[model samples]
Target: MELAQRVQSLTPSSTLAITAKAKALKAEGHDVIGLGAGEPDFNTPNHIIEAAKRSMDEGLTKYTPSGGIPALKSAIIDKMQKDQNLTYNQDQVIVTTGAKHALFTLFQVLLNKKDEVIVPAPYWVSYPEQIKLAEGNPIVVQTKEEQQFKLTPEQLEQSITERTKAVIINSPSNPTGMMYSKEELQAIGEICLKHDILIVSDEIYEKLIYTEEKHISIAQLSDSLFNQTIIINGVSKSHSMTGWRIGYALGQAKIIKAMTNLASHSTSNPTSISQYGALAAYNGSDQDIEEMRSAFSDRLEKLYSWIVDIPGIHCEKPKGAFYLFPNVKQAAALCGYDQVDDWVTALLDEEKVALVPGSGFGSPENVRLSYATSLDQLEEAANRIKHFIEKHKG
Candidate 1:
């Protein structure tokens, strides 16, 4: 059977593969401790669940506007004003199936064949694949761990070209969990503005920050940057609503309209019930977010110390998000593996602990472990990792 070239060229999700392998082992009666799943372990908040139930009881289950329900969009608009101090009318926002879907659709509308999107290394696993699917080239610019895995403005300026359509900025980044400060974002935003490149800011982890560092949208830096920027965010991370499938983009009305049209043909609208649930998420109390963020922070602090204490392991403390990315190249060498991926596989096989090899995130010398689980699980996983390294270290 023949498949489309675009589909054929797509890179399979390494995170999902690792997670599935862990699940398979657990099903076979191995005591697998998975540290690869990227979501919070918390259940959806009861109020949001009740809101969905109420919506269903009130017959809000029918088709909504392709972009989203008007009320939900209004909620989103209000959220932007209150949280980020950015103002947007309803026309500038489009809600989609998820932030991932929102990004995919944005690429489809924004990219022409052979055009390029600048992606920083250690990116979310889906970014490059989605760019490929849209017939765009993903130009990966590798960031150094010494610089906290952030793409510098100089690096951004060097990577841009006439074919460059946009650059992705995922603050409180996914695999690395590091954020760019406002000064850094200002510098990068200026570069993008000068080159007339779109600033695609993915703020999915904005509410999960553990440090005093605030998540600032590059779009909010100035009027010029705001006009050229597209903000992609959702309730998935912030509100423990990952399964609800509600994510959105805020940008100029023209791009938002094009994206809404694309979505009308594609997903038709985000789940109607889910939109109502997200409305509650945006308008309701933020107690749930505070609680979840606190849990992740506590886990991150404790687990990071344990991870850094491991022999031959080095990790930068993350400011936000729930993952710990540790440079384990020395550990891999000491354990007699040529690649960190192999070391990750051996750890899972021997110690029944699952971690995502950083090769998938464009950094082969590291590994990403989610502290989204309980402290007990993190402690146990750390002990197992320590033991594994000790047993194999030569």
Candidate 2:
């Protein structure tokens, strides 16, 4: 049997692969503790679920417009204006299956063969793969943990070439859980503007910030930048609606139209009931979000302190998102392991703990642990991780 070259060239999602391995072990009666899954353990909020139920009851189960239903599009536009202080018309917004789909559509519509995309190191696992699938080259800019794994303006400027078509900025970053400040964003935005480069801002974790720092969209900095930026966001992380598969993008009408056309040929439209659920998520009270954010913040603090106490394990306090990326190279060395991937695999095999190696995210010395589970599970996982490190160290 043979597969298409394009399909054969693609790599599977490492995060999902780790989760599947954990599930397979559990099915065989192993007591696996999985901290690799990205989605929150919390159920979708009641109002959002109720809206989906009502939509199904009202027989609104058919296909919607390719982009999205009119009501959901309007709701998304309003939410952007109110929450992010960015305004867009209905035609400028297109809801997709999720932020992942929005990003794929954006890349498919905008990228060409030999085009270059600036992807900061320690990036989300999907960014580089998605670029490759579009036949675009991924130009990686490395960042250090001491710098909180964020790309500086100088690094951004240095990476741009004549072939550079776009740069991806994932605030509340996927693996690092770090965010860029408004000033940082402005600096990078200026560089992109000067080079006439497009900005792909992934702000899916916009509402997940845990510090005094606010998440600022690069598009909001200037009108010119706004025209050049495509903002991708969704209800998956914010409203615990990952299964709902509803997300959106806001950008210039021309670009949005292109993405919608691409989506029309592919997914056609997002799920009808899920679109209604996302509409309610945007129009509904944000009180539920505030509560979830607070709980995650609390859990993050506890987890950070616990991991820091483990000798030779280094982790920066993440300001947003539900992940902690710790550099465990020293522990790996003590365990006679040569790579973080091997250490992670051994830990899962020996201690029934599952985590993602940093190698998958363009780093080779760290591991990503998601704290989206309950506090009790987090505590137990941390203890098991500590014991594993200590046992290996000795």
Candidate 3:
């Protein structure tokens, strides 16, 4: 069978590949410690579980509206108003299968052939692929580690062309966990506004912040920015409901309506049960959120300390998200490997610690490790990594 050309160029996700390898090792009875996962380790809160169960008991298993149930949309709008002080009508919101699907649907509806989306390097792995899948080009602009892996206004300005259609801003960013400040967003937003470029802001990890800095959306900076930005978010990370598969987009009514039409032909609608689960997630007490954040905060603190103390490894303490991205070039060099990817493989084989190499995230000198596991497991993973480096010391 002939494969489609679009998928032929698609690289399998290194994060998922490493995670599967780790699981295979464990099944073979190896004491593998996998840190490549992107989701929280916690179970869905009991209340949320009960809510979904109640809906099932009531036989709410039928299909919902293509976008989402009206009640869920209302709950999402209320959340935006309460949390971000932004108001949106149901017309501007379309609930999808997940935040990832929201992004995919958005690019499909927005981009034209040869259109360009300016993506910052050290980006989430799917951003470029999603853009490409939609027949758009991903213009990756490399961000400096010194700048906390953030794209500067100057960078954004220089990357623009007549073909430039949009730019992505993933705050409390995946892999790096660095966020753009309000001042930074103001400057970048100005450039996008000047060029009539759209903004795609992925704020999935907003609730897991460990810093005093509050999560600020680029849309919140101004009315113009709000009009220009499409916000993608979900309850996966915030409510520990990764399996529930509910996420949404908030933007122009016209675009959201297009997305809704597209979704109707694709999945018909998000699973009815998961929509109810997500509706409950949003409407219930945020005490579940607070408790989960506290646990992640402790894990981040302990794991960050242990990771940085190891020789030849340098990492910036991330303010949000559950992953630590450390530059392992020096460590790889010290371990006698010429490539970071090889170093990662050797660590897994020899020390039984699985990590996601940063090559997949467009930053080859680094590797990402999730601290979403138990403290004891994280501590052991750290110890194993330290031992791997020590044993291979040049």
List TM-scores for all candidates, in order.
0.99, 0.98, 0.99
Q: Residue 111 of model 3: what lDDT?
A: 94
- Give the least accurate 10-residue stretch of model 1, judged by summed lDDT: 211-220
Better structure of 2 and 3 per lDDT: 3
- Per-candidate alpha-carbon RMSD to the true structure: 0.7, 1.0, 0.7
lDDT tens digits, residues 1-394, model 1? 8988999887788899999999999899999999998899999999999999999999988989999999999999999999889999999999999999999999999999989999999899999999999999999999998999999999998998889999999999999999998899999988887899998999999999998878888888899998999999999999988899899999999999999999999888899999999999998998999999999988988999899999989998989989999999999899999999999999999999999999999999999999889899999999999999999995
Per residue, candidate 2 scores C-alpha lDDT tens digits across 1-394 of 9987767888788898999999999999999999998898889999999999999999999989999999989988888788778889989999999999999999999999989999999999999989988999999998999989999999998998999999999999998999999899999999999999999999999899999988899988999998999999999999999998998999989999999999999998999999999989988999999999999999999999988888778998899999999999998888888888999999999999999989889998999999988888888888988888889887
In Å, residue 177's CA in model 1 sits off its true spot by 0.8
**Candidate 2 TM-score versus the reference:** 0.98
Candidate 2, run of 10 with poorest lDDT: 3-12
lDDT for 392 in candidate 3 is: 95
Looking at candidate 3, the ten consecutive residues that score lowest on lDDT are 3-12
Cα misplacement distance, residue 207 of candidate 2 (Å) = 0.5
* Model 1, residue pairs in steric clash: none
Residue-level lDDT of model 3, residues 177-261, one tens digit each, is 8988999999999999999999999999999899899999999999999999999999999999898899999999999999999
